[model samples]
Target: MTPPPPAEPVAAMVRPASRYRDSKVNRDLLGVMKGTSIGYWALLGLCVLMVHVAGGIWVYQVYKGLGIAGYAHPVFWGAYIVTFVFWVGIAHAGTLISAILFLFRAKWRNSINRSAEAMTVFAVLTAAQFLGIHVGRMWKSYFILPYPNQRGLWINFKSPLMWDTFAISTYATISIVFLFIGLIPDLAIARDRARGFRKGLYAALSLGWQGTTNQWKAHNRTVLHLSGLATPLVLSVHSVVSWDFAVAIVPGWHSTIFAPYFVAGAIFSGFAMVLTVMIPVRRIFRLEAYITDYHFENMSRFILLTSIIVGYAYLAEFWTAWYSGVEAEQSAFWLRAFGPYWISSWVMIIFNGVLPHILWFKKVRTHVPTLFVLSVCINIGMWFERYVIIISGLSREYVPAVWGTFTISWAELGIVGGSFAFFSMFFLIFLKLFPIIAIAEVKEIAIHERAHAEEGAH
Candidate 1:
């Protein structure tokens, strides 16, 4: 048997130790090797100011009513629903990057896995806040749960809201667990370097991590298990979120394609949000070496591929409407393309599904400024896509008498603003407290790639 193909090469199984593990505190924080910049401080202050203004607006909404949000007769969902869906779409990227990429063994994901995972946690919090504010009777929102209430009614599992509660809760819990598990080894690193209260906090979080063989084995097993659990959740949570619209009988809302369509859109937009947040952060933290052009290019390639998928979904929806010859569906499709909400529809097409194609060029994808600009546009386009789907679709129905325009009042806009502010604040705090990049994973990948190269050379 030709000596069993030369014993399959020892280098194929394990890599040599790395210099990264030997580096000191300032030396090892590759992502934040450079100190925080002036821009970061500016962004934080701006975020705080915006949040204060937004909080004031929310208070105004409480004083008034849901009607203050432009929810006239038939347009009950308006901008809050649009923002809700938009934030949910934004939340998809973290799981996709961390769980999906980890499963696929995507090497380029090394640079982004930690920040992207954090984004998932923060985005979920942001989306949850919007839901809390959107539900006018916030305290009574508990009625949607299965707890014994004054009405003596259990949860309506049949309701999309209950499904959403389940999906979002599962998503948030899984994401947090995955994030903390990934942080343990890094926390131990911090614990070694820190003093006083920081040391205590890091030590407690680290759970006595000593980088032993068993600890590393257990850590890897835990990560593998969490990734397995989160993979299905990435699909199920978004599908359940889509059910909020798909299960409804409204003309535009009742579509068989909503589940997959919403999922595709979520991923497309979520990737955009990840890029939007990460680009500035990488720059602020001077993480150019860690988050390289290669990673950005890979991310852009994903964006381009997903943009095509979203475009295909868009075409399929219209084709089905025309093929079925359903007047309500046909009219809903037409209204999206040519009616009052057509602007948002067109913007969604041009920005989310179209503009990302520019990334197919190496120059565009690798260039920081271009990618940053495109990401911002894609994010805006995605928000408008949600607005078009929720508000425009709900604004009109079979009866013209109930047809009305959906407009966003300042209060509703403020809540959306506050959501961003809250998410940013949480993420900023997390960055200071934890390693913004998965140092252990990155080092592992780096070693693996090096070993693979040496083996190939042999």
Candidate 2:
């Protein structure tokens, strides 16, 4: 007997299977499009209000010089410096998960990669904002660049700030490229699904993609290429960021281990932010099917692994300090754990290093509420990690005369709070305006999953 004809195509089983219009994610996104949610509008307003508050303080700083925010004779770096490093550290997660996981072929990451990429973009924005704010002479900030000055001087590549400028700019550019590369297929789907202005906008963004074999092949190749290029840059970006501190002669700042340590911490915190943003968003968008528990569990495993690595780094630093018998190193470590910044130090240890072990239990790992709470704790803990490193380390330097406490002013608080609002508002708007999930990737995965199930049954 002749072999039975092949079963109906998966695409044929679901009419309009290739388009976003056929996707549950698309439908939910369309729901968000009808009108802005009250929460999102509230966040936007709050962010704007905070920006004004920060702007008012910034005006005072401009006129009165940098002393207004409490940088004293001894303390050159203060809350602004601490927050700048913290935000940059927090910015690491999305790109880490997306680029690293993608390279490793972690199928689980596919579900959350779109949101994670978006997070990377937003986190970088927050970091950039801190940079702008931290620079007191904001108007003449371009003076840092290696351009023709009034004296026609050249920028020294040896400068840490120059390295930072290069690294951050490179990283941000790569991040945006990676994000847009992944978004292209989704944009095509959005173009096919949308109407009127939305349709026109997505159509232009889609860049004439019709899902032809050649387009798919080229797009996939480009994504792979960019992801490969981005993976090393991700590590280098934060490593170079850490150099801004490590290159310094300051007692607490100079350490050979800082590059890897900071990169790990950045990845850990970045993942935490991704989860913090995604948990609520996944629920609101009704993307439970696409972003399944399996993905969350896999992500949790990474969180657990990273948490352990960071904990070890903490121990290693202490060990080196003890072994070296360096007075300043011992002082820095002791001050962090037992000094004025002790609360933040202990909080970091308990929340980031200790608490994440809860993931070892499958029940807690899969539970949404627990995961959400844990993500928030992880974020708080990561912030404290930065706090402990910056404030504790800086406040008790070798010269007791220069040692001073760092206090956060309202302006700094407002700006940081506004950054959160800024990230959330952009994400909320993104969900409505674009497909939240990678529609093509999900459809492809779903097809593969069904095929595997069918084969298993046979």
Candidate 3:
């Protein structure tokens, strides 16, 4: 019997298979690539303009010097470093959803993993730019690369910063390959549906995906192996990032708990960011045919779980500081609460710790508009978490006289804005070029669903 008609994305999966079909899935997913409204073009143009403006700011700073962007005194790591960590942290949820959940056989990841993987790759790419930005000499930024240079500069093997270079490089390479592999089957679908130049492009990129049984076997094996390979990165990438601060003898950052704290926080922020981008994309592309509230509910639950972990880590930081009775650590924590940047501290606490508890109510979790707002709050709070950890900690350290405030400049704020624009520009470009939802995986799930439906019909 033919499927009746499409329902909600989640409902479509479980509803009598009569309500959906493979044609619907392919039509809906592929439809995203076939249109470009004035609004989307405008948005993309806006992002590009902002990015160029940011580049101009960078150039101006280069001309004047690093001092123009507020890398002064104790607070050497300004907005660029803060944004660097934020992007790196947000990149994790992609691997978590695509890799870790895949390993665990969590089928809920089926619809969302494609977009999450894209986010991961783009977020990490955005983060990589900051290494050069933070160094203030974009030309010499390649020095952070692992290879020995012609100028006789060998990499510093001992530094956690050095570990960051390897972690980012390794993670980005693997993630891009993983994302590309997942896209092949879908590319083949698009190839068959396309014509002219588009046909030729997809034909080449699809790499002869004839969808034979042998090809399916190879694809599944490859995905399973890549899933195994990527799972550890969910934990390791951010842990290595945390080491950049933890290994240092800095008072607020030198805790043993930093790794887990950072990892949990990363997942929390990462999920929120996924929501932030996903909601708009879903609405804009009419993807509600696939990205339904069931997916949103699951993601909210993840946010709720990680929020609790992150909140506990917040309390635990203060507890450990107080228990250790170290003046520097204790004072740093105190100042974080009561010092000049106390507002950022409280924002992190309320937005990250307090607000997400509302997700305990299923109504809130499944509500799309409310989830979008909450996700934005989480991203902002997470940014402040990094800001508090870096700036607030560095601003008031051991010596009273040497400690100076790191006031943000227009250039710094502009670059932060630009980083977001850069990420958005790439993501906008990607939406037109690729299926944001996994077409092949969704069809597989639909087949499983139809099998159960047939059994029930008996």
Report the number of clashing residue pairs per model: 0, 2, 2
lDDT string for model 1 (23-125, tens) is 5323556336235667667777787888888878877777787888777877787777777778778878888888888889887887788888898888887
What lDDT score is found at residue 179 in candidate 1? Answer: 88
Model 1, runs deviating above 4 Å: 1-21, 24-39, 447-458
Expressed as tens digits, the lDDT of each residue in 132-161 for candidate 3 is 887767797767776766777788889999
Cα lDDT for residue 272, candidate 2: 76
TM-score per candidate, chains pooled: 0.91, 0.91, 0.93
Q: What TM-score does model 2 achieve against the real structure?
A: 0.91
In model 2, which regions exceed 4 Å deviation?
Answer: 1-35, 450-458
Q: Against the hidden true structure, what lDDT does model 2 obtain? A: 0.78
At residue 340, give the lDDT of candidate 1. Answer: 91
lDDT of 2 by residue, 73-178 (tens): 5565666766667667766776776777777887777778888888778778777776777776889778778888778788889998898888888887888888
- Deviation of model 1 at 2, angstroms: 39
lDDT-best of 1 and 3: 3
| Candidate 3 runs further than 4 Å off | 1-22, 150-153
List the global CA lDDT of all models. Answer: 0.82, 0.78, 0.91
- Lowest lDDT 10-residue stretch of candidate 2: 17-26
Task: Give RMSD (Å) of candidate 2 vs. truth.
Answer: 4.1
Best model number under lDDT: 3
